[model samples]
Target: MATTTTTRSFLQAVATEEVATPLRVVQMEGLVILKIIKHCKDHSPSLVTGQLLGLDVGSVLEVTNCFPFPMREDDEEIEADGANYQLEMMRCLREVNVDNNTVGWYQSTLLGSYQTVELIETFMNYQENIRRCVCIIYDPSRADQGVLALKALKLSDSFMELYRSNNFTGEKLREKNLSWVDIFEEIPIKVSNSALISAFMTELEPDTPVTQCDYDRLQLSTSSLMERNMEFLIECMDDLSLEQQKFQFHYRSLSRQQAQQQAWLQKRRAENMSRRAAGEEPLPEEDPANPIFKPLPEPSRLESFLITNQISNYCNQINGVAGQSFNRLYLMKALHEE
Candidate 1:
């Protein structure tokens, strides 16, 4: 009976197709945001991840609770160990009488370098299990720059279909009309604070003396972020160039081998025909131990695509930061003249 029930659940999961839902709006509780911010800040410089627990309504996923995962080896070999640890944590959460069901997961990213295969694979797994689950990316580095960068994202329907097919060929992409923009659907996040908490915060607001803040927004510290982004973008370009060279070399080698194989087959056929014409038994046909050529294995292009996407993201971020910095500089100049 247990096996039957398991089979039925599996069938139900497979049969349910995720429709193109309306734009998701994430309603995150104030406490949930605080916990995530604290978790990310505490684990700065190293990527941190946690699970979000909440209820999902038709258009909004209300996140109420979260807990950070235990630190684990980042190597792929210990993935199973991490999974087991998460399961144990989930069991404990169930005992605590809190919302333990995983509505989604959250990860900290530096300068938005979150578009990797691991993230996509994790999201796929989570969405497969819970269709409405979203991944929240917290940019701690950006947050330190006086902006709380929290974005809730989900793999778009077309992107999920393309990924599940595992066919990223040019033709397939064209058929699906997929692009980098289609990869992630960002949901607007609204922080919901209780009245009591709001009152408490308001009561504490007057504890500090009010003073005029001069040039707070005009700080040029954004230059450092812009520099780091440029450096990373350059490195990615170098890696992309190397990947392109590798693909070119592979294709050239493959073409040469194919040509040699064709020539060798033709020569053998000619020899066989000549021998038969001479009224002699054709030489026993057998493939040569060392064939004329062997094709090189095709290299995986997934990493190349991911790197390209990351570079694009960096460019977008740089543009935004630069624009804001320019506006600040203009304002500062105007204020000084005044």
Candidate 2:
């Protein structure tokens, strides 16, 4: 088995090296692509959680920080599984055909509500040209999302780093000049999970123009109307989360986590260094035997950024795909009011 594995690895490397860059590049001409990310934070202090959306070439993505975790265990586990699966999807996109045509949407179902999976499936079937392109769930026929079905796709370590560029940060909203409605007509919203679709349709009443319904009647618990759906959603989330933590404990890295710890140590060192420069004594080192310095229940560093810049960019990206241009920050502000 070891010999065969080595042979396969060698062949893959050789194949990659032999293929010319131009030839290897996937030809994505008329294809519309959507990009999703797990951001750390958002513009608002109270908002948290990352987003999933389509990319806009002419403008940036509009992201927000409202990552609601799954209330149910099963739902949480699946989302955790989806998060890991996303790493591979990121890699797969690098070589595939890419174009200026992009759309952005956020995953707002909260974690674990396998209902979001239904959203994705719906989008896939909504239009002939549209593809869900999720990072997880390799086999459509499988009963459960398998871990091994994940395929490795290479991505640049610097991809997310590009958000820091002046263009991404400094650009102002081009408001009056932007037109978004033209692009909205192109998308086909497919429905795969009928239960979710029916539920949403029943709740969604026709209001204004013949356009799509953007607002959801999130009828709070005073009425039984929303109770059944809400309870189911939360339960799915909790289950999903537990499974995710289990997978992380079993398959995730010790070294990588340790390195995160090391980075924290370095940050503390810097804080101490500055204090010492100002004439204060630094604190004592953490005892190696103590478990106090260990990883905690806190969110990862990625979450911190997702809540802010990442969230804003994600939101704006959707506008670009919709053919409307707007300020990234303003989009989030507008989205919040609704």
Candidate 3:
């Protein structure tokens, strides 16, 4: 029988749609991982599916005793029963699989860009930084190549247009902090739903960079934007307005490659679901809608934010910190990586 897929929202920041391109990167890695496991697959191999997949933990032993049994009903009292319960819970916790599969699920767990940043940090840490005997993750430069499973180009034009269609210049957006209100300051935040706003305000922990303080202080929750990380989110109108009159080739292709990668992930996920329904083994950790992929498409400078006038914004096209750094060899990186 086909297992019903989980529908709970796995990510807390950006919606699945917005970061679809990046998620494809994870999907490709999962496929590689699955293949690797199967390569060593012996019916009685060294690792069981649960061990490899990180799911086969100890079975549950729902309390067999009825009514706080062993705790004298009439003796309403100070027996050490509570202490025993706590000990048993601790034992169960110990059996938790300390494996990569469970941890990797969160690499693309949809904390929006927050988790993405952490994932990048994990894979990009290097031998030059710290040499070890274990397998080192591929460098950031090679991330897109490893994520061979995604076809993210199909939506490139649509998403690129999203940033482009609403194009506005940084000149229009006075040099101010990028708070939610400031972004939409041309329009103040208002709501007919207090509950959502209250919920949003509650979730705003002090974990983001100092720059996001304005958003942290503001009240927002039920808002449509709670799904997105405010830092990665640009002033849509301002982003387009600020686009340089000139466009570079690499940045353009990165945008398209991102779109292609997302498409590929979606296709693979559908097939995986079919495979599961046919009574094949349930696969490794991954959300079908997400496919857990991210293609490391590097951006070209000259075409994207690198304007002849030296104007720019850290753009969605490049997926890096924004600033004057955009001007440095936008074309060269694109040419080299492409």
* lDDT by candidate, in order shown: 0.82, 0.34, 0.30
lDDT of 1 at 13: 75
Candidate 3 residue runs with Cα over 4 Å from true position: 1-338
Error of 1 at 41 (Å): 0.9
TM-score ranking, high to low:
1, 2, 3
Model 2, span 144-229: residue lDDT tens: 11111111111121321232221222112132221212111112222123366557766895676543212221111222322433
How well does candidate 1 score on lDDT at residue 25? 90
Best by TM-score: 1
TM-score of 1: 0.77
Model 1, residue 331: distance off in Å is 1.1
TM-score of each: 0.77, 0.19, 0.17
Please write out the lDDT profile of model 3 over residues 1-338, one tens digit for every residue: 23233333434333563443321121222333333333323221221111112221222111111111122233335346644653554445445632222212111111122212222233233212321111112112112222211111111232223233343333222332221122100111111224664577569755655534333322222222322323334443344345432334545765776687667766767877998889787555444455324443333321232222111221332333222134234644676799
- Cα lDDT, model 3, residue 332: 47
Runs with alpha carbons beyond 4 Å of true place in candidate 1: 1-23, 74-97, 161-177, 202-216, 265-297
Ranking by lDDT: 1, 2, 3
In model 2, the runs with Cα more than 4 Å from the true position are: 1-287, 291-298, 304-310, 313-338
Model 3 poorest 10 in a row by lDDT: 60-69
Error of 3 at 116 (Å): 6.3
